[model samples]
Target: MSTPNRVYLARLAGVAVFDPNGDQVGRVRDAVARMRATQRPPEVVGLVAEMPMRRRIFLSINRITSIDPDGVVLGSGTLNLRRFEKRPNELLVLQELLDRRVQLDSGHAGSVVDVAMECSRGGEWALSRVAVREHTGRLTRRGHLHQVDWDRVHGLGAVGDNRGTANLLAVLEDMRPADLANALQDLPDARRNEVAAALDDERLADVLSELPEHDQVEILAALDRQRAADVLEEMEPDDAADLLNELPPPEQDVLLDLMEPDEADPVRQLLRYASGTAGSVMTSEPVILPPDATVAEALARIREPQLSPAVAAQVFVTRAPLTTPTGRYLGMVHFQRLLREPPADLLGGIVVNDIDPLRTSTPLPEITRRMATYDMVSMPVVDRNNRLVGAVTVDDVLDHSLPRDWRDRDAVSPSSATHDGILDGDDE
Candidate 1:
């Protein structure tokens, strides 16, 4: 007996199907898998074969013998010519599994780029593994495939069943918000929004902050106006402004009206900045504190789990009752300086004037240079009145510097491009 080797689904889809007599009967169209109760990989139930006259038939694995890269060879001389009909518990691999988004237990997610199948010791061909590609774009389609065990994927074998959805969610529940966002974007539109709806406002806001503008808009549009407003409230002013800018004026106005004034004000100010300026991409909320705040007080604010890593590294010192657009921009104190200072000492005495602040109107290139020159991860932005209005984090600056519309482009040609007929829902 020839040992079974793995074959790519894209290459297998159109391979010839032959009977024992060696006469070609049809072309392979798709594979059918039956879900099992246990953790073992799902079993390959049959193959959907397209015959002459455009007639399609289901060839149960029980009837056929070998499935190899060359073609499928049947064990019997006579073939079943009955038209193919999908059974309720059966999953069409090409139509439902391949190229579909799946969540992994590793707190990561990606599309099923391809499948690996092998003939078992018992002589039946079954899916052995799947290739999940994280990046999808012009350059990434031809990219490296991260092969994982077939059992790790959710949303495949148990199609349309609660088990699969539950398993998928279990893997996603603890995923980093940004990682979850990447996973969600790769899912089919309906499934993507379904998952997005399940995330809490704060969690969803964090995910939205990591998503591209187009995806951010799509997810927000999918949400109810009130929920969208709540999520926007949880997002940073700059990220929220970026999302709002992408919406039509009428919709934007409606959403803004639904938001609390305090939350909407900073975003409104950010929306006023021109597209490529400092004010355009700066985060209006940084960790600000009064100059008179003791080192102990500063440490407490830094300890808040909600503060992003970049914002937590430094504290902006402003004149009297610290607030955005404060009475005056005094100076800033780095977190390292705080640990060394006496707990009772005031921040005003420890604040450093070493780094220069960027004006709201500073050009994008100049702002980029300033951050790079000072090796600063977060830089303060001041208005004409010298009041601190925002701070631009390095991540945001890099995002602005990237090619426009980069997010909207695919990382690779879609997996379906190679075998469109295999993906046709009507066929299953």
Candidate 2:
């Protein structure tokens, strides 16, 4: 067989560094690239050592002669260096990162357990986020932690550097609402609810909307009426409607009554549509711009703070008259299409008229068929009068279609076929 490809130094950053004899030589720290005179790839340059005071040592990429699942073997018998340099402003050491807190963002937190490096990113390297395991109680219980890519990490800070007495909850509390929501998904139900209750109305709303339907129900059921109402008010109308539809009729009515009229009205309107129909599933929160508006103007409108959070996808351009009580139905303007075209292009010119709008009364199966045929992720819902009602996302359809028989699998007899003889013999 031909010689295998030699793994580069940059790819070996987080790889377990070992001596030629297979003795562990600490993990590869960070890969450093030095600019070269020619346009060729940067030299393997140096390695930020994971051990011996987290020192930085220079090593040639050619030094890494082999790689295996177990560890890496250096071409040289041992890594020898005359001198090493300390990374300027480097506060974290590999030992410290092993069990220390790294703030993913202001609201999200996790303990660093291991760093992973992508061997394929040429010479580039990245830090991988891993959940820290902690022991508790007299029994010395341990729990699993989540792993997230470092790219998703918005910020990083050190927590509990001294010892194993870190407060995970306090660190998690500092993360942003969005990041916190993501982090909480990995928490236990009781702990998740506790964290949800601890957040303010806005943060609670974010977390609730981000949650899976079952978890959302649990959190909402646990919240007081006022808090539930506040969260519902903050949610997109379609999302609010879907959430309310899951609740008991009495509980739903109570929460609806507590919400502001403006906030509750859209949800009520959405509820009038059939459960899987476009109107019932559509979000009333789309960014609607007049047909006459230029791309620049539409962009400006999108940038405005007053726009709903639901408008992140696209700006729906309707005939100015259509926005009124008697306005007629018009086409749509997707954000991607808008960005690709010239800025001077009129919103009307860029409107995609081929999109098929769905009626509130349309059957869900038919809607699903159309979605599959068109490969559309979301479709607008309208009423008999062509009034924009709500939007249905592909995810909503998939969620609805997912079989509820998940628990039924456990009820099945594992040996049903083989047990038939036993049953018959017993009857005899």
Candidate 3:
């Protein structure tokens, strides 16, 4: 490869990645480096590129024809579609290192601004330079910028209480909640908490739901009681209930008490049901409308950007009260059916109640069987009084059915792993 002797990894973020034929494949997300046992600088692994559909895959540095500020050209088009998972001893350059608090060999406190990787004469790449900005301790003036050898920096190998997250969060701002969660799982525990803590309540709530249960519990615990309650309030009630279920009753109650009465009420109700039942896994906030609502109104409600695809796939129609515990559950209408109906038509005239709704106490196995038989993405759950209470989506069923710790499944050790991840890119 013909490239500059040194490349700043942070600047490469969002640079387009292309096939040899000049077709765009993805954009640079971050650089991966394998930490060394000795004082030697970490060896540069490859670039994590965000492909079409927000799928991130690894591209070996060896496959690159050239590298610059513009774009990365890949020698091969064949690519692995498997999701990228981080292995121990592997550091994500932008996510884990940037905005890190560090001290210079001269003992000046500063924070990492960027990192540069240099190519060796033998063709191997390694992180070799550090760009840091000194803490001016003055609000009127910006800090002094320093570009020094990687070895001249201290505190880069560990987390500090004063680390800044504004730069790191900026790089992650455009990512989807699930993608951001994957990136967070790759960070050191303390760094992960620091970054997660920096996100606003709504963003953190979205990311927390995507994270593994243990990670969710850990990040939530890292926050103060009031802030934790606020984040939980922003999450979907079912997700908030699911996360709270992981904590002991006393801890759960404390956070619940801190949440607003309206938000806490639905979650408290969800918590009342036994695990493995419909009520326990259903989302209390799925798209809901009254029977007298028009097709256009139902369409508009489903179009709300905050609604999950599964939740928005259909609209549950009921009588009177539109919220959970709504009066007289009246069935539902799929968005597809809505598209076929006149905008002025009332939902009550064409609702599909053919499939029976799951009762709160119904077992998950039965629910899954029925959903599969009916090809439904989501199914309504009601109370004995025939009032709409919640809706169980396919994702909820899968979450409960998967083995605990599935998110932490084993990956090939860093020592043995080839290009792309635990598995070789070619094989995957």
Model number with the top lDDT = 3
Tens-digit per-residue lDDT, 1-428, candidate 2: 01133332323435576666777665554444433454433333335444332323444444565554455566543354323333333322332344455555434554555444333335332233344443334355554455565544432332333333233334444544544554455444665676677777766776666556677898898888898999899877777887898888898889999999888877887777666666666667666777787888777776777444445456666654544222555767766777788888898888886877887777778879998998776677666777665556676666566553211212222321211111223210
- Return the top candidate by TM-score: 3
* Residue 214 CA displacement from its true place in model 2, Å: 3.7
What TM-score does each of the candidates earn?
Answer: 0.63, 0.52, 0.83
How many steric overlaps does candidate 2 have? Answer: 10
The list of candidate 3 runs beyond 4 A from truth reads 2-6, 14-29, 32-45, 48-60, 68-71, 76-92, 102-109, 120-129, 138-162, 409-428
Supply candidate 3's per-residue lDDT for 148.
93
- Cα error, residue 371 of model 2, in Å, equals 2.7
Compared with the true structure, what per-residue lDDT tens digits does model 3 show for residues 1-428? 86799999988987888888998888899998989999999999788887764556777777788888889888854665566666779888888788889889988888888999999999999999999989999989888899999999987777456568988887788877977887787677988898999999999999998888899999999999999999999999999999999999999999999999999999999999999999999999888888889999999999999888999999998887888899898889999999999999999999999889999999999999999999999999999999999999999998888776655413212232334533343531
Q: What is candidate 2's CA lDDT for residue 428?
A: 5
Clashes of each: 7, 10, 0
lDDT of 2 at 423: 20
